[model samples]
Target chain A: MIPYLIISPYIIFFLIFIAFPVLFSIFLTFNKWNIISPMQFSGFKNYIRLFQDALFFKSIYNTFIFLAINIPLQIVIALFLAEILNQKIKFRGFFRAAFFLPVVVSGVVVTILWQQLYGFDTGLLNRILVSLGFGRIGWLIDPKLAMPSIAIMATWKNVGLYIVLFLVGFQTVPKQYYEAADLEGASHWQKFFKITMPMINPTIFLVVILSTVGGFSLFIEPYILTGGGPLNSTLSAVLYIYKEGFFYYHMGYASTLGLFFALIIVSVVVIQKKFIEKEV
Target chain B: MKKTIIYTILIFGAIMFLYPFLLMITASIAPENEISKLTLLPSSISLNSYKQVFSKVPMGRAFINSLIVSSTITLGVLVFGSMVGYALSRLEFKGRNLVFYIIIFTMTLPFQITLIPQYIIMVKLGWVDTYLALIVPYLMNALGIIMFRQYFKAIPQDLIDAARIDGCGELRIIFRILWPNALPALVTVGIITFMGSWNEVLWPLIVIRDQNLMTMPQMVTLFVLGGRSEGQLGLKLASAVSLALPIAIAYMFFQKYFIQSIASTGIKG
Candidate 1:
């Protein structure tokens, strides 16, 4: 009875915040109504329409573009920097803090900062390029370049998290393993591939899955930077849902997209668990 | 030679990481035309942009609103999330394992899955356009609970047993003994939760319409990106600075604690 008294508040909070909303959202997927009106029964129409939605496909394509460029580059850069900093450098603590600085900054600030950096006319990137005689290039304005530009920004903002992760993973690899490899006359490259690679495989796998989910859920960056502009080239799945639900008031359609997005995450996560987990 | 090369690389990477922020401060002071010119440093410094943001945008009020909501929510996580985590970890209640498993399973569910339902609930409860809408639903974080549970499980059982043997209540054992031993874990969760709430923009954008209730991030989103001044670069840049500067100052001060907190979370991804 005493324990129940203590735990009841938490149980109540969780039910209100977590359990209730989850079950309600599933029910919402089957209804056809704007949030303002009486919800009408519309069995599977929203889900059916999703198959033929061109914008949905485009958003999916854009999302994959983000993940493809960001995850590998981020992981590789983080590993390199982590390895370099791990070598007992002067100001190692300062470098670590500097590398991790971007992680603590809010997503909104990062997006704003990047938008300025990638500004077509006044952007530092183009200014440097033109000064180098590479000529000015349109970054956010060109449809082809917009999503990749967003990916670059995403990588810059988030690579810090993975750097810290890789650093932690690097520390956990006992020094004796590397010492034994050194006695075998293994090159540094060989030691990294043969010894370090397998040991940190789990961390790498986790980063990939995280970057994938985060990639698909791209919202604030594109919304703030591009507004899904230049022919919707940068429009992401979550941004699309925001438009459908909030901008267009298509609650039923947005809920359907949400369900499908959840399915994709669940399936991909399961596949990763089955295949990637075994290899690592 | 290797050490020289490593220092060079570290210096280069640090510059790359810091350049955007440097340019942000510079451009926030740059004349509107110079904004598009790509100058690395400002020709002059002015507090005009900061003044413009504070006068035009409800920045002060928004900052206060954000402070209240995030602090309240952090306290809720520390007090409530710990109790729940303690019960799950140490108590022999029915459904204990099942409850733990369910919480872990829920973490995998994307926010979109419950976006609509949560919105409707907020609407039904008359919470829209209120701080409660922003803070109440997010009061219990799945990650916070899990982090606490992991830390609690690591505590030597003898402490809890000794507390029990002394005839102290279970709540006292948790609050007095377990919590004191768990300060690191609490700080870790506290910092992350506070940061998450402070930076959250989406729900606030939808739920808080009145200018007085808007959080800092949400307010900046509307003003800077909304093309409010016929594309005034100076004004927008100033607003962006206002949005970022407080958080940046906080980060600079508490960076050591912040990094340690993130490292301790052992976030898988």
Candidate 2:
């Protein structure tokens, strides 16, 4: 009884918020309910509708496009930044903080700030391009450019986190291994590939998973920057769910989408883990 | 030569990362006409935009609401989480392993899965547009419990036994003896929880429609997205600064612990 008392607070919250919602959401996927009415059983109607939904498919496709562009860019840029910072350098703390400043800022603020920079006209990027005699390009307004533009901003906002992760990974690589490589007259590239990359593989794997999850869960960026915009080009899975559930009040269908999204994320992560574990 | 190359790269990276913030702050204070200019320096700084932010929306109210909700949630997590942590780590009880596994599972489940149903629960309970809607659901964190459990496990069992021998209650043992030793973990979890609650937008956006009850991030988003401050670039940027400034200031002071906590705990923003 005393032990139960000790753990009651967590158990109560977990039951109400975490555990119950998960079960209730599953129940919701099989029923239709708006806030004003009582829930009614709908069998597999919601799931079937999800399969036939074009916007659902498009949102999933957009999310993958985001993941494809974002994962590599984040990895390369963060690794490069981490490597540079890991070196004996002046003002390392200042540089680290500066890079990390964006990560600490709210996503909405970052999105709004980027919206200003990516504005079609009178924006910073176009202004610089015009100064350099290049034609102005519609960043957020163009269908083809909108998703990539959002991806780039997402990378900038989040790369600071992976830099810190990679920095820690880089530091854990044994210095004596580098000494041995130097004794063997190994080139810098040779040593990095042979020693650094293999050792940091775990961190790389973690970054891949984290970024994939982050990319799929993207909401505020697209929500704020483009409002899933011009042609629904930047519409993400989570954003689609938000619109369906909140905007259209398709509670059952939205819950179905939510469940599918969670399953997709879990399966992708599991598969990635298995593949990476086999390799490692 | 290598040092010069490194410095150049670092400087460019710093510029890339820090420039938006510089732009935000300067743009907020810049004369309305000068906002679109690519200069870091505002031609003539003015408080006009900030003045507009307070008048245009419930910016001050939202800030206070955020402080109340985040601090309350943080305090609850610290107290309740440590209790659960102490029990799970120190007490030999049935279902302890089950409870621990449940927490681990909950941590892996993203909030999106629970979001709609949770909103329904909030609605049924008539919690909408209330601070209880924002704060109660978040009072206990699984990560905080897990973190505290690890911290408590490091303390020797003899101390706990000695306290028991002295007729000290479990609560007293926890608060009196164990907590003092676990200060660093408390700080780490506190900062992480505070930041998470402070910067959270999605939940508040879903739960609270009343402008007066909105968190800072939600208010800023609403103020910008609702077109309430349209074409007033300085005013828009001023709202962004209002949301970012408090956390940025806190980060500056606790930068070391902030970085350390995130890195050690593997919690992302």
Candidate 3:
């Protein structure tokens, strides 16, 4: 009885918040209901509509583009920063905190700040470029550049967490392996590729999976910066869901999108897990 | 020369990370005309933006609301999470593995999957635009439970056994014996929960419609989104600063713990 009492808070909240929501959302995927009206049973319609939805496909494509740009950029940059910070260097703590500063700030604030930075005429980046005798680019306004610009901001905002992850991974690599590599006259590049890379492969895999999941759920960045603007170039899966539910009041369709998005995320994560487990 | 090169790179990276914040602060304080100036430093300092933010919105109310919501959720998670963590790790209880697996499952599921339904539930409960809407649904974090369980598993069984021998009740044992030893884990969960709730915008945007009841991040975003502060770049930046200032200050003090918590828990998603 005492044990149950102790654990009851979590159980009750879980049932209400976590468990119920999961089951109810699955149920909601098949029903047509806005916030105001009665739920109408529409079997398979939402899913079928989702399949036929061009904007849904576009959002998926845009998300893939974001992942293509973000995941590689995040990995390389985080790995580089982590390697440097892992070395015996001055002000290591300061540098780590500096990199991590943006991660702790609100995503909305970061998006707003980047909105100004990405502004065309009087923005910081363009100011520097024009001074360097280069033409200004419409970062968030241009369809070609919008998603990548948001990707850059997303990378800046999130790479700190990955750097910390990689740093922790670096610490776990046994020093004896490095010492043995030194004894064998292995070059720095050879040692890194052979020893460091293999040892930290699990962490790399984790980062890949994490960044993939994050890239798909891109919302606040595009929501605030572009409003899914410039021909929906910055539209993301989550943003699409948000718009469908909140703006259009199509809660049923939004729930369907949410459910499908969840399935995609889970399947992608599971596939990555299996692939990484087999390889590493 | 190699050392110099490394230092230069590290310094440059630090600047890249820190420069936007510096820009935010300078822009927040810059005179209206100079808000968009392409300079590192503001030409003149003014508190007019800060004044405007306070006057235009219930910035103080939002800050207080955030504080109330974050602290309540943090406290709830820490206490309830530790209870579950202790039971799952130390106590011999029925359905232990099931509960643990449920937590792991919940952790894997993205918040979006449950978001619409959760909002509906909140609506059903008439929690919208109230503090309960912001607070209750977040009271128990699955990640917190997982983290606490991992931390509690490391604690030696002998200590718990010894406490039980002393006639301490299970709750007493948790609060008195195991919790002190789990300070690092406690701090980790506490900071993470507090930061998450403080910076949470999406849920609040969905559930909270009242201006006075809005969390700082939600309020700031709405303020900017409404185009009310359009062309008033300093005021907009000032609102951003107001939203960010508390977390930034907390981070400065708890920098080590923040990094330690994030690295150890790996809960960011």
Docking class of 3: medium
- Give residue A230's error in model 2 in angstroms: 2.0
Tens digits of per-residue lDDT for model 2, A1-280: 8999999878888889988888989999999888788889999999888889888888988988898899999999998888888877888888988888877778988988998889888888988899999999999999988998998998998898888999999888989999999999998779877899889999989998998888878998998888898799999988988998888887877878888899888888899899888876
The local distance difference test score of model 2 is: 0.88
Model 3: how far residue B245 lies from native, Å: 1.2
Worst 10 residues of 3 chain B by lDDT: B260-269
- Alpha-carbon local distance difference test for all models: 0.82, 0.88, 0.87
Give the per-residue lDDT digits (tens) of candidate 2, residues B1-269.
87888888889888888887888888888887787674688878888999988998989999999999999999999999899999999998999999999989987886668878888899889999899999999899888999999999999999999999999999999999999999999999998899888989888888899888999999999888888898678888899999999999999998988888877766655
Chain A TM-score, each candidate = 0.95, 0.97, 0.95
- Rank ordering of all candidates by DockQ, starting from the highest: 3, 2, 1
- Number of the top lDDT candidate: 2
Estimate, for each residue in A1-280, the C-alpha lDDT of model 3 and write its tens digit.
7778889988888889988988898888889999798889999999899999999889988988898899899989998888878889978999999999888898988998998889888888998899999999999888989999998898999899989999999889999999999999998778877988889988888888878888877887887888898899999988888898888878889989998888888888898889888987
Show pairs that collide, candidate 2. Answer: none
Worst 10 residues of 1 chain A by lDDT: A1-10
Residue B198 in candidate 3, Cα distance off native in Å? 0.9
Model 1 lDDT per residue over B1-269, tens place: 87788888999999999877777777778866676554677677677767777888788999899899989999988887888888888777777777778788778888877776777788789998988998888788778888888899999999999999999887788889998999988888988888878888888877888889999999988887775634666677677777777767887898877887876664422
lDDT of 3: 0.87
User: What TM-score does candidate 3 reach?
Assistant: 0.97
Cand. 1 Cα-lDDT: 0.82
